[model samples]
Target: MSDKMIHAYSGDEIDVHWDKRLCIHISECVQADDPLFEVGREPWCVPDEVAKAEVREVCERCPSGALSYVDKDGTPEQPASENTGQVVYNGPLYLSGELDIEGAPEDMPGVRFRAALCRCGASKNKPFCDNSHIAAGFEDFGAIGQSGPGLDPGSAASDGPLKIKAIPDGPLKMEGRLTLKAASGRSAWQGTKTALCRCGASKNKPFCDASHRAIGFKSD
Candidate 1:
């Protein structure tokens, strides 16, 4: 996958954009709505054949932010609020609202409304979930206190840029303008600095429980 390349498919009513490098090959686009993302078909994506709303729905389901769309009517589709994230039970870290992944290539779309990040540390697509947790038998109870102090969204609002930096062989260091939520939609914490466990061994997950140190988790 070329990190700098963006493949775009323009249709009559909408345009579908894809960043191949960000795709984890979860097959959500092909499985959810095959008519638009047929693998063997010429041009592969036939956005004209499907309704604009249908195409947009599938794009939103893409966990890696590899897929996105723009309506010809000029209605904005990107999320326009504070960033938020949640820990899925025995699964990926679900993120929503406005987000900015730090250090992404200039040509790539740096911001997104939603993303399912891989927490198991087994994903072939490092940062994004490709449903590898299920295959890897990852186990987590999604406990509340394990995540640390909860942040009040109303109180933590700041104009700083949201940043997520993947440290070499370490946790995902998140800083600036973000909220961490539980599965129940309750705020777990809101802060400028939070280190999320990426090696899947954190007992205090989704926070870094220091298991990465004992397990010798190496991303590099």
Candidate 2:
């Protein structure tokens, strides 16, 4: 999907905005207790149908940062206390924390707190996942890899923004504190920086093994 803004549902207590471009249709909102978010109805999102708190809760679960809610009181969604990345089962990398995605739109709410990044190297949307992995038949068990340097148990995990830079036709260059976890929620790697494979050809799984070059992956 192309980068663009969509409709906003304004309620008395909150305003819910949808960026359809980033949505991979995870269906978190559609499954909420309220009918505020439905798939086929016209004006699919009606924030007034749900409580303000529930709207925010549903929006936060959106991995693609496609949904966001603004409280009338001026309070914004806060980033997760700990920077973390989860390798989805044969899918994108889901990140939660203060995120600084290179070249991402600055005005998109919740974009800084959550993102679903393409790891299958087939997304026409580039850095963001567009559910292209499924059609491309990308397969990975999402297992924890060799342990990397981790922060001491007593040390505080950095509460700073994780900078993600998509290298030209290469891996995702991640900087800043982050704990990369497997699908089982087990820590696989922890560090301030790492290069993650996006070409779906790395023998080392998540980590880059220079396979993109070998496969002649074209990201542009």
Task: Give all TM-scores, in the order shown.
Answer: 0.75, 0.92
lDDT value, candidate 2, whole model: 0.87
Summarize candidate 1's per-residue lDDT along 114-166 as a digit string, tens digits: 66787999887767676788899999867666444444555544554567788
Candidate 1 local distance difference test against the native? 0.76
lDDT (10s digit) by residue, model 2, range 71-110: 9998889999888999999999999999998899766666
Off by over 4 Å in 1: 2-7, 19-45, 49-54, 71-76, 146-157, 184-186
Off by over 4 Å in 2: 1-5, 152-159
Clash number for every model?
Answer: 2, 0
Candidate 2: pairs in clash: none
- Error at 52, model 2, angstroms: 1.0
Residue 160 alpha-carbon offset, candidate 2, angstroms: 2.4
Model 2's TM-score against the true structure: 0.92
